[model samples]
Target: MEKFVRVKGVAAPLPLANVDTDMIIPARYMKALTRTGLGRHLFQELRFDDADRERASFVLNRPACRDARILVADRNFGCGSSREHAVWALTDFGIRCVIAPSFGDIFSGNARKNGLLLIRLSETLCDHLRREIALAQHAAIEVDLAAQRIRLASGETIAFDVDTDDRHILMEGLDDITRTLRHADAIARFEAAIESLMTIP
Candidate 1:
């Protein structure tokens, strides 16, 4: 997983509230385990029409938002199922940070595990950011993880809170597997000790 230290990129406004995991990445797309290809199918239903065609009206479908790295959304985002694919899709689609008033509990955990920054702020703050993004598609937003500050393209800055351990993981690019592998030598030593103890004298 890529480390998220300080991200400065274009912000996309997803005004709708309560976007679920299924909506982010449909279950049909779960056939593939790799997170790479899911970016193409992110927001499958909303981004594309019933004919599987791109919906020009969709924020992601819009040219300005197609390459957005920071997603500014409304309240209760990422609700419903606890599929990790939802976070995968977002990160795969080049969205490193998501700012919303609230997020589904399970989805929040998934986001951190998948190296995505899920920012929870007040509803008023979210609305302010959403409006700011809508005003300018090319606006650049700066997400400083180290400082725990969100600086908008409009020159506004806001503070946010993140769990200390999660913040460390993001900063060090350490995932569960990566952390376990870091102690490979210790694990090997433990196995050797167990083998010696089991062998008859």
Candidate 2:
């Protein structure tokens, strides 16, 4: 997992609501059995045509939105099935942060574990930021995890909310395995104590 203390880069606008996990990385692409290569299939249905051509009209396909590291999306952005691959695809595609009004509970947990920062703000604010990024030539924004605010190219800042534990996990780049390993000494001691008690009995 990558530490996400701060990210400053191009911001892409996804205006559609209820952008589900399947939409993020369709089920057809899940056969790879590895987290790698999923980015190419992200939004496969919407990003490609019948002949497997890139759709020019999609927001992510636009020239300015290419290589965007921050995504400002509409409400209920990560809704639907609980595929952790969605977060993997986003991170593999270089998306360090996502801003939306809400997210699916499972998706939120997956994202936090994978080191992708998800910011929750009001729908109105998300829409405003999405529109601004869409219209701007640079479409660049800054997300500071320590400050819990997003800074637009125009110098305007908007506050967002994230769970304190999630924020700590992301900032410290603590994946599930790493988090567990941090308590290795304590776990070893507990196991030894249990073994001694069993032997005495």
Candidate 3:
């Protein structure tokens, strides 16, 4: 997983609440075995129409937000299902972070494991951010994980909070395997002791 130290890019405004996993990436697109290539199908239903044409009304399809790396969303984002694919789709689509009032329990876990930063803020603060981003000349903002703050293009700053463990995981880019490997020496010592005891018999 890539380390998420800081991200600066257009912050897309997704004001809708209760965006589910199926909406992020429909199950039809989950047939593939690998995580790659799912980016194209991210927000499949909302981004494309019944005929598979791009929806002009979708925020992601708009020119300013087409390459957005950060998303400012409403409450209860990622509310349905426990699919990790939703997190995959977002990361694959180049979204490194999502700012919402709250997230689904399962979806939050998937996001952390997958290296996507989810920031929880008050509804009023998120609304303020969305408004600022929309009015900015380029709709770009910067999020610094080290400092736990957001800097808008207008030179204003806002503080945010993240769990210490979550921050460490992202900053160190430590996946589960990598994290486990950090205890390699201890694990090896324990195994060696067990082997010695078995040989004593």
lDDT of 3 at 80: 89
lDDT of 2 by residue, 54-134 (tens): 999997899887798988888888899999999999988889988888888899989989999988888889888877776
Whose TM-score is higher: candidate 2's or candidate 3's? Answer: 3
Q: Identify the candidate with maximal TM-score.
A: 3
User: Of the candidates shown, which would achieve the greatest lDDT relative to the real structure?
Assistant: 3
What's the lDDT for candidate 2?
0.88
Better of 1 and 3 by TM-score: 3
Better structure of 1 and 3 per lDDT: 3
Question: Which whole-number lDDT from 0 to 100 does residue 187 have in model 1?
Answer: 100
Q: Report residue 63 deviation for candidate 1 (angstroms).
A: 2.0
TM-scores of all predicted structures: 0.93, 0.96, 0.97
Candidate 1 residue runs with Cα over 4 Å from true position: none
Number of clashes found in candidate 1: 0
Please give, for residues 129-174, the per-residue lDDT of candidate 1 as tens digits: 8887777656788999999998887788999999999999998998
CA lDDT of 114 in candidate 1? 80
